[model samples]
Target: MSDLHDLFLTCPKGLDGLLLEEAQALGLTEARAQVSAIRGKGDLETAYRLCLWSRLANRVLLVLSRFPVSNAEDLYLGVNAVSWSDHLEADGSLAVEFSGKGSGIDNTHFGALKVKDAIVDNLRAEFGKRPTVDKVNPDIRVHLHLDRGQAVLSLDLSGHSLHQRGYRLQQGAAPLKENLAAAVLIRAGWPKIAAEGGALSDPMCGVGTFLIEAGLIAADVAPNLKRERWGFSNWLGHVPAIWKKLIEEAQQRAEVGLAKTPLWIRGYEADPRLIQPARNNIERSGLAEWVKIYQGELATFEPRPDKGQKGLIICNPPYGERLGDEASLLYLYQHLGERLRQSCLGWSAGVFTGAPELGKRMGIRSHKQYAFFNGALPCKLIMLDVEPRQFVTGERGERSDAAPAQGAAVIEQARLSEGGQMFANRLQKNVKALGKWARKEKIECYRVYDADMPEYALAVDLYRDWAHVQEYAAPKSIDPEKAQIRLLDALAALPQALGIPTERIVIKRRERQTGKKQYERQSAEGRFMEVEEGGVKLLVNLTDYLDTGLFLDHRPIRMRIQREAAGKRFLNLFCYTATATVHAAKGDARSTTSVDLSKTYLDWARRNLSLNGLSDKQRLVQSDVMEWLREDRGEYDLVFIDPPTFSNSKRMEGVFDVQRDHVELIDLAMARLAKGGVLYFSNNFRKFELDEGLAARYQVEEISAQTLDQDFARNSKIHRAWRISVR
Candidate 1:
């Protein structure tokens, strides 16, 4: 292995550590795990070792060159400088993989083309024979990475992504990635647990990746030890003796099982199509006896008889995205939790999911939620401690009287079309139940429904602490206005029943439509009724919007502004009806300016201001807030800026996308602030990331607490709010 050279093995995120172990086992002594890849030094023999044995990696690339590259030209020049002739044969085929970050060059495919051109041009000029481009099954693969104006080029040593564990001759729908499964096991401390002879169970195993990987781990078998070939074997520099020595050591380790106990890995899945494929994979991995597969519903499946040692249970229950029926899915999770409590004790469990609401249905507070990426979906691996049956049971039985009757004929009747009659019944019952809980818990100003739309049919939401609500559309046609009325009625009655004054209640609605322009026909179907509660006037609109009149998610934000608004000058930009500005004014703001382009909304803002006992002394500007911020000389001590994610209209100077101009918008908004002013900037774009550097120009702290009210607390990323100050 003396002829070895520097190499880099890039794996998908979260698999770095596992890949590193495989590299070390293969005699790449210096393999070090980076954030998303591994780098080490090895000869061609070492490369071959990795190709045959790395289970938790995407590909392994051999380092070719590292140079400073500023733009496209710099990238081309750096690629051309590499000695391509030394590696490429006259008739060989090649492919270039390019990834870019923090540079002017944006298109990844275009960058790959430039590198390809450079390599072909360099080689063709030297030998009059250029390599053919082969994307699939290329003879040689080159990787080009441009990060922060610097480029690092390498040769791919692994032909296919390491996730193709070869044992997976058959696949199921959205089968778990091999590398991700391995990482999850590692993160769950599987090695330590397996060492104790703890039985392992995957109750919802789809394709048996977890069971197979766990079997391999228990038997001390490296994941990638059986790969047949590697790209580096064809490279000019090759070694044999030292590579064989490393393989000898690995085989020796495998000859000895980690323990003498019988293999205790088990998997269960109800899907008929997945059962055979799972068995096939296990058999191919030669773990047929060590691992067992069962095809049955979890309701009937029982754990294997307990051994002296306690075992571990892990599962990835189907989220609503892959499955449907929220109530059904929730019931599944709830039952799974019950089964764990009943059957498995002295054991730990890990449940991974992107849908938190579903996780909540499990009814057990996780000890820890490990963050990992399941493909592009952000997922959390929740660890639960299910101790022996002797713990916390035989105490509470017989459900509550206030628990709205479920699974009854009433539920079926409620699903039928009856002039919102069944909806009203369900909505009222949900509201009453929620109100009862809130009063018992002593919570006020809570949430009622997420959204009441035809699409979100009868999905009544309930909350006492934070606000989030929604109603999905029913299959059959119903009056959208009547749905809004039913929702508002529930919101209005909730606070009163919960011991909160009707005047203190605030109701909101959210629409998913593209708000590119105002509705061509603006007619008030039903006027909002203002009610009095606790000396404050409560404004509730049952039919004014696709929603009526409240943004429940911002309740926390409103409360925060009120708490911090004493004697401060307040400015509310893009003030849609200015409810927040009213909250600020009630907190006794020195002055408030509500700026917006819509005269109708401006009038509504004025009404909200007056409803809170404020007057024209509070500034109400009917001008474009963006232009106003750019030109206004007035200063404010507190600002509330919440813009649409995107908009196209002649009302403003140009098309606006919050993601594109966040830094500029923040900079300008801060310009009209007093010396020690603070601005609460918010956006509803789910994937919004703050411009940390720009935001850091001022003291910034996230204030998304209001956005995570009880109703919308299920997803923290739904909206993000941050406080920027000039302290």
Candidate 2:
């Protein structure tokens, strides 16, 4: 064998470019990037150095042979050609890992079995003893890749994955892998920050992954310095003297780096149980002098470094994946943003999160964003320059005065007239009461003031920061002059009471529309904003339509569908924007089909699906729901049909009046449901009632009380829903 060898270093997805850069820096020649891996030419010593210093690599493999393979026989012959004795002893243990699929073998388990059989057969013929199979702590780990009629074999030189640095034997519920944490730190510019003698802090640090990794980088200590076992330890081709020299050199560099002025690094964790574990990890990494851990709440978290210090504030906040998590996470991000603006002025910050939408609520603009993947979940690292320019001051929530460190903003409350004061007080009371329930249930869009007093007959809906106010058309008996005067008073008190900007309040007239007039385009401004519910993203435009595209009263219905849609087929009829189907698809539904008569809403539904990356296996049909139901033959496990109160569109064959046509629509939808399947029917008409005869035809239960969330509790007549099932 030649001194120069072919090597491949595997890494997590999105780190391929970083792995190539690190490999070349570690003396791997002619390095090239591949999918989640790097291939290069390196000598044995170079390979050893890379295994020791590579912070982003998962494993390093040394290629032994590449041969053409047509079928299983060719794979066996190709494996038998390599000299097994040169790598693994006959009495030693081995493991086989096979990837890719081609030729005859279509499954990875069968391919691995065939390769193992060939290796054992070859060893038994030569030494009269076959090696034992050891999946854990194997002496030799052989890997095979069969692709495009060819096979390449390699020996794993780093033993287990390099991400297991052995320092963190215990972690929190969700721990970032060591290699990925290091990659996040590097991308966040920790190396450059450390070189400038700056400090580092993680406010929500779990078990010190970021702190220990940052210390290792700053101290010039190899990430695998504490690892005692390696794949090459028992190999016959290993050189003891060359490995010893590399270890000595690494130790010297580490000692010199540690003896210098230590960098100020600290971690604050909310969980008291995690503080000790984080401290233990810091001590085990020999970074006790440079790092500290404190049990602190995020509300009171204030990192204190030496005076005249401006450094990086990096944190990996929890990106929860639950139905009721967005509302709480919105506040959490806002609190972090408030802290950054209040306490960490002139410092840089990086917030790594899988929930990028919540990150936008932080009220700061991240100048740079880098995409990465944590196993399969894609995430983004939002890098912020914590200067005056990065603080978010948009038209929705403009900061009128200098931001006060204590709370959200420092807006001077406007002086209210006698009537406006009462209106503001009433609005403030409703916000205080509803905000708590909103956070508890994760309700983003809600009705705040629904004409509590007859004098001010307007309904207000809060969608995140923007407020949608619809003035109810008054009876001619009430003076029109007084109604206008009250509206103007409410407008004057809105910005102060709600703590939002005047430009974000959308006012519209809510009159009784004559036929299909409600469906007409209200405006063309097209200012769409994204909102989250049940862990799915939805697009809503307040100024473009009469409705915001998401009905707050139907949130519970959508969440139930999201929870029950795994591996099931889902259908939506009269699907305005297909928001419920979006939730179902995100819940891992096998397939989704949405039917509607409006081509405009179908196009909007397409955008909603694509936004959440749920476009695969989702079908959108632009046809009237009744007509489509008659022609469609596909069966569905879950169906949702929420029709308008009345419609007389030119596109439809006939009029759709819920009071007159609901029974026929329900029967048509029930025909498409599979046995033991569910179909949810709802309508906004206050007096709408289900046909009494249909209950005898199918199992039906009224779920209106259960479907009404806290936001719509006051207005029980907003909508009514039913759960119909096949008997």
Candidate 3:
């Protein structure tokens, strides 16, 4: 083996340029960038320097032999040609990582096995002993790449991928690989920003990846200074004196950089559990003095005034992986954009996300967007310069201004047009009329506005002092801009008429939903408020979900449940948040069983039940309602079945269409009914037609009219109810 050898420094795709630049800076000769790896010529010392200092590399590989091979026999001969004694002893352990396909070596595992056989056979012939294979923590790590009948064999100089900086002992879900994090920081211009004494902030930092990477960059600290092991630690070709000198020099540079670098770095995570891990990672990285992390929500995240006005705000907010994540993430992205526009003026902001459509919801134009991959998932890094022009104006022409006076501008701009005035007048009238009835009924939550005007197209509900607005999705025939203006007009008029702050008003677009769409989370804010209805305290989350915990139109139905629930065993089917179950429990029912397919809502029901001290004799079961009804043998005196109009949740064995499945669902519930039981079935399918056979089989009465309280009088078709009893 030659002392000077061809080398390759591999990195994640899209980071080849950065790795090449770092290799050149490290004085490697003839450096050239490949697809995801950089090729260079260097000696053992140069390789050691790259291993210790290169932040963008995943591994540093020293090429041993390159040859053309057509079959397994040829592959074995090519592998045996290398001098194994130069890198590994016969008694040492070794491992092989093979990749690519060609030349009759179609399977990676088979190719790796063949190469391992060649190495062992060569060593046995030369020294009558062969190295044993150790998959983990091996003394020698070898890599084989095959393409188009050519194989390139190399020795892995980094035991693990260089991305494992060894500082993070713990991390949250989907933590960014350290090399990828370094790439994001470099692309965000963190090094130049730090050179200019600028600061860095990550408002939604989960494990402080960005902050730690930024700290390392700002302080000129070697990326692997704390790493204790390497692939070549026991190699015969390794030079201990040269490696020691490099380590000492890196330590001296880090010491001076730590003292002289003036960089302000901070991270904020909403989850308290993530805070301690983030702190631990930062401390382990030896950047504790330069970085700070705090537990906080994004709504209150602001740039530190003392840290100056310019810096970088970079974050990799959760790229929702589950079914319900997109809806919830939309609001989070919107809030992030708003915060950037309001508090990060004169700074640069970069948002890395796998869901680019969610990024569009930010309402800010991006200056640049670079495509990269988070593992196999293609993602984008959106870079925005937070200038005045980047601030998006709302429908009322309210721009995000950093000054306090900007809020007054928003309120002042909230004026009503002639149509808007008429809409506002109608809302005021309904509030006055409903206000009286709500006070008399002791109801703190009720529908105050229900698309009173066609142009307005909104349902406004009052939850105590808070206003929850659900905008009806406008028709495709209407110009989107016009509909947006009308929405803006309605949003502005609500706060003025209701005497509430804009922050207290939560808005969601309500369209006809199918499947599990409606149950999807809209945000992870978890901001719940306690509201009283029928003298029961219920937890309501207006911003986190499409439907508030309690349905305003179902007030009379719950009241009826309370009236007839005394001394009876109550079963609430499709018990969303179990608000009716709470009413039944309050009504002194003998026992209550709430069944729903959603564990999230069941947990919410548990909390609501706990809030009212109604935990005894109450069971919250997570099961498919239809399946549960078929399997349940226990009898109940009063049963309430309020199911969705259509559901195709994977949790359910089959599809559920209320109009089609109503009779079957009723029969199943009726089978579990007691001798004098009454089954109340309800749904919101507007064109529902009751099965005439059900009426003949049992006593059936349409109580939908009675179920509509005064608050829901304007829309009696909101839900239909039927009372069934055995004849």
Candidate 4:
């Protein structure tokens, strides 16, 4: 074999260009960038250099042969043509890694098996003994790629991925990959910043991946310096002398780099449990003195004054793909933006996030944006100049002044806008009118505003002293930008009009939801506030869900249930959080049974019952309402059935469309009714129509108009209610 070898370096997707530059800088000839991999030529020493120093390459492969293969037989012949004894001993262990698909090779595992069989057969035919396969730890590791019937066979020079680096023995949840972290640093211009003796900090560093990588880059330390083994270690072409010389030279360079590198690197994590792992990783990387990890919250994180000013601030905050993450994360992103504006002025900022909209919520416009992939999810690496000028000149090219005059003028203008002022003035009038009615009725939670002005489409509800604002999804005919501007104006005027702190205002976008989306968790904040209405205390989480635990629109219905349930046994179906059950129990019902399929809501129902001093007589059942109705044998004098407009939950047997299945649902609940019993059926399906035939057999009165309270008078179609009894 010649000293020069064709090599293929694989890296994370979207980093091919960076890997190409690194490979060429390492003296690899004819380097060309490909999608997620780079093709180049390097000798034994060049390959060793990459294995030791390349921070962005996942694996460095030494290509041994290439041929056109059309079938499994052709693959076998192509692989068998290589002299197996020249690379691995006949009695040694080996493993084959197969990738891609081509003619007659669809399964990667089968292709790997065939490649293994060819190698073993060739070695056995030459030396009368075949190498045993070692899947865990092998003496020789081979890689085979099949693309459009062309095969490229290579040796896996790096035993494990170069990103492993033998440093991180402990990691936190979703720790950024080391190579990807390095790529982010490079894209953020960290190399130039470090060369100029600038500092770097990661506010939400998880297990110190970015901190350690940045430390290595700043200190000129080889990424794989501590790696004890490689695929070439036991290969027949292993050269100990050349490897030792390269190690010595890298050590000398690292020593000189560490001594004069005036760069400071620090990281902060809110999780105390992650601090030790970060310290352990930094210590193992021989950068303990350079990288410092502090257990602190983002709200309190600040750059160390001793480390100098105006370097780089980079973080990979939670992208929040899980349920209920986006709601709570909005405030976090807003806070991060404020912190940058206040404390990190003049510093460069890099924020890599999977949720780009959430990044936009930061309010700091990026000067440059790069696309990258974190696993399968495409993400953006946003770079911002965290200076006064950038902060003042926002994404809209508008000037934001720091003086109180400018702020007050902006607020005054928003409050005086033709549409905004009318909405604000109407809100004040409603507050005045409702204030008297609420005190007389002893209602602490009620709707204060419901799109009084059509241009400002929002529903503002007061929960005790707090305000919960739900913005209706705008129509496609309206300009979204204009709608957003009006929303901002409304938000600005709400606090002054309602006499509530801005922090007390919770906002959510309300669109038509189907299936189980409305019931799904929107945030994990678990923040709940206690509010009272009609002498009933209910728990409401304004920020953690689409709908607050208690339905404000159903206040009259619950009050009616309380008035009717003197001594009768009551049943509440689809009893979300059992707010009505609390009312029925408080109204002296004999016994109450609440049925729903969600265990979470059932637990919530139990809590609500407990909160109101209700008794064990009120039982919460977790079962599909349809199935429960089929098995129910107990008779009830009063029953309330309020089904969702639509539900396709996996726990349910089939889809439930209220419009299509209302008759069946009504019949099921009516079967459990006693003689002279009343069943109150209601739903929010706007287009609901009653079956005339059933109304003829049973007395059904449309009492929807009577159910509307003064607050919901404007939107009488919010829900429909009916009182049914046996004729």
Candidate 5:
């Protein structure tokens, strides 16, 4: 009954060895690292000590049984044979959690269900009573893992994953995973540095993961110092006195170091959105009194004279992946390096990046490069030793030429810790599954969208025969460029999935605001054109929006209008490129009128019309569609009304949001329509709710069916297209 037991501690990736060291240092002997995990042999009290004190481990599990499991039946028997009552009470509630790789059983839920069944059935058959399953918080949490036909059942000693440090009351977009953040700090040698009075800094810290981790380590604060509950609380052989003594010891350790000058932990970002969460994280860590954060562009940032003098400057800059446009983030990276090099003399710098191209812009050679996993991105935490001269000259504005960029190299055999790879592989599998579905459904002309925010992490949409299926990788931080490259790689399969040739597919990247897009004065006319290629003409417009011309998601809608335009009088309202009008004119429309508020857009629309062989008779009007609809009396057989969600300083006489006044806009377009004319009304606002009353007033049918192009199959709301007529 008192035999030493083999147990495992699961930490976030890169912290397995560190956790092993921590456990061994705490007298849990025979510690070993196994893929984001640490294993050791001890009685149940060792598990209690880990739950109470271990910082890097996500969870500690008591190994119940290990057996060869070929299938679900094998899994059941292996789990059922374990003495469930030995740990969990007959009337107690238990939960089974499962995770595995290279096993016949792939579905984690089904695997968990099998394990649950085995436990319940065994207890019922043996003692005539079955334990209840509690998911929210189980009295006893069991873990069933299968790896290469081997099943290992264990009891979860940590009620929850260790990453829930209980300090973070708020978070920003793609906040670093707590365990990964800890691993990053440990890897950066924060514990050792802090012990030696070497300061820590996170210049681009969104939520102060680096700085907070550093502060906790420096203050001798246990990673779980603030956590309320651990699974060992319910274990049969728990040691309350020893746990209390250890906690008190940790508190006593924390009380010793009250540094007069605050620990040099500081974070800065241009956006207040990031700053808000950084403050919350720091405050929650109880380091608010010690840590300082500032809001300003990196270019304008002046490092405090006394701080970061001989400290570390760490930054996780925006990767063009989720935020969009790698080409634009270069200046930000360069600016950051310039600021650090100019101001932070004698500072050691750590730049963690998924985008190696941005690394070139830093203009400094790294002394060491630590390959680490920031989620799935095979990122490099490049360390640079800065000399005072480098700082002085960099401050003096020795700006270097922005180097020409190259594609990010594909990461091969990225070594991820156990759960890291598992989750990443599972995510990769799901993305691949979505990609496969896209191909099978003949999807094309669709957006792979993640509109939620921070513009990063993961989401993909496949456009197929008039339908869209969106696959998302809920919000999690990864390398921005890696995320984008993966998205593009998935996108490369889109045309094939939709049965459309790659030549016909158009890729439009949303641009981020930087010096490239910033113009002191708006050009009077937008200069863009229609280029003919591979049997179809492509219209590209640059001036009116962050994007150039093509709205690839509307490919099917535009084609449908073209197909229906022969012998019809066409009207394109809020037309930017007027590509649809040109397509209509190409289909022999009797006449066409293209209206938009932007004179720049109107000129681009005119060029599209001219490029498509349309004459002056197919008029391009530079006027607001809303105002034009009020005065225009001309009737048309085909009308296209696509308005922006909101615009203030536009050519439009007034602002417009399609969701707010779409009914009136539709009514106005219908007033200028012929008796049997068809009105194609559309908007890109995904949350737009169609007004049934407005549709009832007119003879309308949701022509979303016709507008569903092969490429736009993933989401029909890339734009909601409808057909209406006056009753």
Candidate 6:
């Protein structure tokens, strides 16, 4: 066994089986799979081949020794027993990485230190000189693993984690590692597809991981051919001739692969900022000629290939980490499914997502589902046979609605569904009913339709020229397939019935949010557009957040503030984006102060003020409204309080539940009001009950009717309002 080395190939979790197969195919003999690792016997050439071509492995480690140890002294003795002089120079630098902990080795840091000490001491004793510790770019990298009562020491043949292919130096926020991306492509049958000269595409290609990996596979290029350094580079037993021969073979293979492979690989990213970075990564990977990235959105995603060329669509769509982020992501997955069915009639799709529940919403039936872990988060790669016959109806029968068709034919069916026509008719009726009123009132941003037809549970609001559509989550009793068809109908009808362009129709899902009220920036594109309300310009970012900065239901409320704000100092509490303050300032308010707990909203408020030229008479403040009211020593003629129903922001001193604390909040506001001043209070909590004790304490009027404008007449319970004044 002198010519063979015991090797362990480690990979991302849940990839042990795949890694085992790849390793065996790469000439690793006696291969067996363990948890997140594969143990095998291989000659030096086999190790080099695994390091070069095995795409699923993270590290290839050659076992040096195995010993039974229960304490630090024994561990040191086991490591020191290896002849340090045989593998490395005494004056060379080395780094030790240790994993697992037990048997008196309580932590990994101390374990690594002990291993480093033993190696250095042994080398110094032999050569009268000590090796230096170089954690970064070390001459030699060693691994120590302690499991239960046994210890295995090894030399890392792959210098870095094999996932770091040196192509992607810049990436998106939640990037899929290169090795994991390769696993997804392999499981998606990309190698077979590419061998047939098929196409490949990723709709949401953040930094182009899938595209680049697929290109390498299609070209038969070694995954690590361009890597310059390895663990064996500085070792004493390193064979330069064999390594040089292997590298030359890889280069020749790459040259042939590059010259002959006519692959159509592309990626589409909505974020404009990432296109250059993705292009740069592709350039670095030497796949720029084979792979191209463009700035396009999921709604408009389409692969550009020659006619009759069907390929694979692979994407790792974002599955948000919290409820606040899910509202927007639900629509993204739906759009992906819709596009796959519409454009790619016979193409295959691989969707990798952590939230498997969201995968079911794609409507297409997956023939197979594979489980893998992105680091520690468990994920599923669902393989879809995207032909018309594979819709996920219980019978797996062909259906008119979900069948793959040409682009125009898909749109025709999308609009011709009985449910879709019904949805479209209701939208037309709503526009006729509300268009006259909206135009007469000069309301640029208003709701035109809010689920008037029970089958279509969507709210379509007009944001100037764009339609902001929100789909309310259907009841669990409703079939998701039926719901999806109806939603698509509604979306298809929106552009035509509402007289808006297809690209301007933005869709969202209305999910019941739970958890702290911490705002999450979901999209990398921080896009914002200005819309006019009450003749005042307000900024609304439609894609970056769930709520489009301005709340449409509060239009009448803000207009009333403007009408009554002449020559009066006003205070606006919880003034998100300060839309109301802008109107108040426009109406010639003598002075104004707007308070909120979020610095982000405050900065937005400042921008709103600046955009409206109202900063001269207003102050945008970042503070808890309760705390600000308690400390302020000012009187105002007009005061508006639109507090959130509940808040658990860490920026606030304590939790805020409006139902329990509204009275105290009102009392604090009243103390700062002038004798004849008016204080208007409001909240969106539907089940809220104003305390009976409030009427007896002061003059109060329920003005919920006045705030219910023509646009929100259908959903009158959207919010509650009140007018209170000192008695």
Q: Alpha carbon lDDT of residue 80, candidate 5? A: 85
Give the per-residue lDDT digits (tens) of candidate 2, residues 634-686: 99999999988888778887788888999999999888899889999998887
- List TM-score per model, in order: 0.55, 0.62, 0.74, 0.85, 0.58, 0.77
Candidate 1: where are CA atoms >4 Å away?
Answer: 15-34, 40-53, 71-73, 101-104, 240-262, 306-308, 322-324, 388-470, 473-727
Off by over 4 Å in 3: 1-3, 294-309, 322-344, 355-365, 394-443, 447-462, 465-530, 534-553, 558-680, 683-690, 698-719, 723-727
**If candidate 3 were superposed on the true structure by all CA atoms, what would the RMSD be?**
6.6
Candidate 6, TM-score vs. the true structure?
0.77
Off by over 4 Å in 6: 194-206, 255-279, 286-313, 320-346, 355-364, 391-678, 683-698, 701-722, 725-727
Instruction: Please give the CA lDDT of all the candidate structures.
Output: 0.69, 0.86, 0.87, 0.86, 0.66, 0.85
lDDT of 4 by residue, 1-727 (tens): 2478999999999999999999999989999999899998988899999999999999999998999998999999999999988899999999999999988899999999999999999999999999999977899899999999899999999999888998999998888899999999999999999888889999889899998899899989999988998989999988888899899999998998878744789899999999998999998999988999998888887897484556999999887655334344655766687777767867899998887666665656688999999999999999988754455333243444443343222211111345556677889999999889888888888898898788888999998898888888899999987886687557656777888866788888888998999988877889988878767788888888899988888889899999999899999999999999999998999999999999999888888888988967998889999988999899999999889989887788999988888888888888899999999999988888888777977899999998988888888888999999999
Return the top candidate by lDDT. Answer: 3
lDDT of 6 by residue, 430-462 (tens): 888888988898888889888888888888888
Tens-digit lDDT string for candidate 5 (1-727): 3478888888766667777788898768788889988888987656666776676778888887889987788888888888777777777788888999545688898899999999898888878888898887778888978888988888888888887888787777767777777666666667777777777666677777777877877777777877777776776656677678778877776666534446777777767877877788778777776787888766666556353346677777766552234324644665566666566656677787776555644556566777666676777777776553222123222433332235211111112223333334444554455566456644333344443222233333333322122323333466656565444433333333345443333333443223224212222235444444212465653333444455665666677877898998899887877778777887778888888767756766776766656766788887767788899988889998877776555344455666778878887887888888888888777688888888668877777756664434544565677778777
Q: Backbone collision count in every prediction?
A: 33, 0, 2, 2, 30, 0
- Using TM-score as the measure, what is the rank order of every candidate, best first? 4, 6, 3, 2, 5, 1
Better of 3 and 5 by lDDT: 3
Q: Looking at candidate 4, what is the lDDT of residue 12?
A: 96
> What's the CA error at residue 453 for candidate 6, in Å?
12
lDDT of 1 by residue, 82-169 (tens): 8987787867888888997646689998899999999998988889988899888777888988889889998887767877777888
TM-score, predicted candidate 2 vs. hidden true structure: 0.62
